[model samples]
Target: MDAKQYDTLQQSLSPKPSIIKNCLKAFLVGGIICTIGQLITFFYMAYFNFTERTAGNPTVATMIFLAMLFTGFGLYKKLAQFAGAGSAVPVTGFGNAVISSAIEHKSEGYVLGVGGNIFKLAGSVIVFGVVSAFVVALVKLLLVTVGVTNW
Candidate 1:
């Protein structure tokens, strides 16, 4: 068969995706995840006496820890399958990525496998965050020096 014929056959065989349904699913799942995070923050503020500003750090830590635990137990995979990018666009996804990578490499040995490969997926994220923060700080510094903003 010719290339054009193969392409036609492939397109005919592929199932059409339901964009609206997928979007609704993603929106609901993502919203639920964020709501859970907000509740955790509120819990910290109410029970632990943390201020709104101070509650952010612990809230994020708790979310990441919970995500890692869920990933370890294989629950995050099912959620990811259902929610798609909804499950991946949050900090919890970072935890899942790190733990999943470590788990995948565990068979090769501890130091060489887990340690070396643990950050294989997450390292880029860390680098991007660091670089983005530095760039933002530089821009703010320049703005302050030029009297366009205040410290």
Candidate 2:
């Protein structure tokens, strides 16, 4: 009836979360995803004659493409459900977000719906990445100008 009574009732009715178990699951799943990415990087370096530095771009593209395929097949949903933030803290998650938005809006037509909405979720990520890179570059430039660092 009273606010305090309702609060107590809600607290008592809620189930306790298994923090340790959830964290273990997330850690394992995230580690596996990163390992897969690393393997892809190695493959590119070994087979495509790409150096370690040059392999990074192709590795990232491969990971994102795989994520988009999984999202389209509805497999990423299950993985996200099971792995929680594990499946979401990687570059693959960005691909999943872009494709999922497009798939959800496909019914309204390609240009107005899919094209316009495809980047709805990923736009913030892109902006943040660009801004962060600019800030880091500015800092590096200042440091270089002051003779504190080299290019």
Candidate 3:
């Protein structure tokens, strides 16, 4: 190949600052998400008579709900504007994906409506994650039964 052609190919394959930037963004956003959950945990424990451990799980669930709610209300778009892939690379993104699809398709009417399209983008990730977990479990089971693995 010509040097120019090789350079172009290399540029296409090489990692860019944007990818690293997005990843760091995802990390920061994800971290901020966890931090919010932590604050909720503390709030519940201190003000609502809940124990620390009991508060945490529910706080996370609430965060997911709020994220979904925000997306439903068209608020997540603004956050995504600020956070970039930070907002796009978390469970909040999944919520936005599902809810936004639902709203976008809501005019299609009942069966063909929100229910049918709500999961559009996020569904693939959900399916992949579940399938991967099942595969990992099966592999572990096989390894155990075959006596070739030790944890």
Better of 2 and 3 by lDDT: 2
Over 4 Å off in model 1, which ranges? 1-9
| Alpha carbon deviation, residue 62, candidate 1 (Å) | 1.2
Off by over 4 Å in 3: 1-24, 43-57
Reference-based lDDT, each prediction? 0.93, 0.93, 0.81
lDDT of 2 by residue, 72-144 (tens): 9999999998888788888898889999999999999999999999999999999999999999999999999
What is the C-alpha local distance difference test score of candidate 1? 0.93
* lDDT (Cα, tens digit) per residue for candidate 3, span 1-151: 9999999999999977677776777778778876777887888888887897788667766777988789877889987876787787766777788878888898998578888887777889989999999999999999989999965
Q: Name the 10 consecutive residues with the lowest summed lDDT in model 2.
A: 16-25
List where candidate 2 sits over 4 angstroms from the true fold.
1-5, 147-151
Model 1 steric clash pairs: none
Clash-forming residue pairs, model 3: none
Better of 2 and 3 by TM-score: 2
Q: Which tens-of-lDDT digit does each residue in 1-151 have in candidate 1?
A: 9999999999999998888888887898889999999999999999997999999999999999999899989999999988887888888988899999999999999999999999999999999999999999999999999999999
